[model samples]
Target: MSTTINSFNGDQQQSSSSPDVGDLEKHYIDAKAFILSATTKDGINLYDHLAHCISQLLADQPREGTDLVEDISKTIKSEATPAQHDTLRDRPAPDSEHSLAAEQKPLFEKVDHSEELDDEALQSPLPHILEQAYYFEQAGIGLGKDESYRIWLALKQLADKGQIDKLRFWGKIFGTQKNYFIAEAEQNVDDETDENELHEEAHISDDNRHPNEEEMDDEEDMLPKSTYKPPPVVPKEERGTGANKYTYYVCNHPGGVWVKLPIVTPAQISQARLIKHYFTGDLNKEITSYPAYPGTERNYLRAQVARISATSSVSPAGKFKFSEVN
Candidate 1:
């Protein structure tokens, strides 16, 4: 009985392992019919049809396992072909005309006079002043030696250039945009005359006034006239002993072009005292404020410097005495 039961179990396992011959024959027939129909319609052999089906299956499959290097190589190949074609088409011909000789330019030329200027600067009284400055520093009354020497050199250069009888380093004035390195110099009589003449040439006369001035005059005439005459404007003082005593040259930095400030007018000084405005570094900048300034920023700066010097200037006792002889 045990042998019979063992035999039955072996038969069941054999039946489960073996495939049905009828089902295999049916699948073979169906595959043959589909291949025949596909070949007849597409005019392609079974092998080509099978290969196309395999390619479609591969294309439809997810690319998650694709090789990164292969993709990059394919991308590079795809992009390189178009670029190569464009490059070949746009390539300049070897025989194309091109100017070989560009416009001839002169070589850079340097004309430095620093050494000569330095030698000349040493010949002035700056050395003596520099020596005295050391003692002044010891007494806590002057800038350090290095700073004093630098200022001395600058002052000497300014004196030589301006043909000044006397030159001194005026204190620096801080501004909003930039600071002024001031140099006070006593000008020669002839130089002052020449500057005055140049200013006269630049001054606009009533005879050649602008049309806008004429219109303004007409408008003033149409207005009601009153007998209230304003006080006559004061004449500008001479350059020897008053606010215009010394010609002021200002530069934003040392070793820069020193600009001679226009002589300050009394009107400018009066107006400057009324309104406070920060300096904009531009000499030609207009001052827009109550009791509008009569001149540009240069005039305003000059007035302020004059005011500061008058208020803060100090001298040793008996160094100067008031006199009414003039």
Candidate 2:
């Protein structure tokens, strides 16, 4: 994930007043770490604070940065309504034409800043940030709806260093309502914790607090979670391939938890060669590989190479040569 931030330094400078390359890298790297640690209650509050800061930065005009104190000083003296002052205090005027209220659309809106970048930033920094933010969340960073917006702000700043239309650019991440789902899932998990606590309280009187229960709690806290077992591989008939069809490989995941690659027959590769494109066989059968780290699930890793690893090869595992795929 940190490597993703490093790619920003390679971007061509878009503006003289743009954020320094080193500064951008440091901020994003720090922000990624901050998000990953934000699952606790205090951690969540700190995350929202960072999101608020990012929102303030987005509201400011290009290169001016956010100056809420000065803006409020001027607002108090002007004839602006109390409501207008409140709004300005939160967000500066957007680079594009839109009211502050409209600019703050729900997180899943169709807005994207990648289209606003020059070729270099578009192809490089912009995508790098998006990919990092995505995997960061998938790695159980647990970025809820609110924290996810910080990702939007970061991308917008990278795209048009001096200008971003808050309204026009306001859209959902990856064009999906995933943030909504993530928020709902978090709420459900939190509710379960509360329910468990209530159950414990109802059963235990003040004088009868079980020493065994306390010991169990401490033991549970000390123990690490077990290895995640993915759903049993149920090979689909249509996508099935003979064991000898193509060279098979597993992700060289550092933790030694790896999945079989979906069978791509030599015939399929041959046809793809003639067409000069990768073949999308049985699009529904794609198998995706998630970040190969502890505590991450393969299912949670979206946009992974899901298609290739649909079924395990019939050939003996760990018997293939890397040169065969080449």
lDDT of 1 by residue, 1-326 (tens): 99999999999999889988998899999988877666433255555555554564476564652554355444434443443334355665554122211111111123355664566455553336677787887898886776666566666666656567667777777788777888887766566654642564366244335356466566735765467866866777766658888888898655556888767767778888899899888887888999867767888898998888888989889999989796
What C-alpha RMSD separates each model from the true structure?
A: 17.1, 36.3
| Predicted structure with the largest lDDT when compared to the true one | 1
After superposition, the stretches of candidate 2 with alpha carbons farther than 4 Å from their true spots are 1-118, 121-124, 162-326
> Any runs in candidate 1 off by more than 4 Å, and if so which?
1-150, 193-223, 315-326
Worst 10 residues of 1 by lDDT: 99-108
Q: How far is candidate 1 from the true structure (C-alpha RMSD, Å)?
A: 17.1
- Per-residue error (Å), model 1, residue 235: 0.6
The sequence of per-residue lDDT tens digits that candidate 2 reaches over residues 1-326 is: 78776666545344555777899999999988877676543233445445555665567644655446456434433422233334345566575335423534432355665556666444422334345557767887645544445444534433343221121112222212112111001011121223432442354345344257466667745666457866543432222233222221222111121232332323233233233222222222333322221111222121122233333226677787577664
Clashes of each: 0, 14
Per-candidate TM vs. native?
A: 0.54, 0.15
Which pairs of residues collide in candidate 1? none
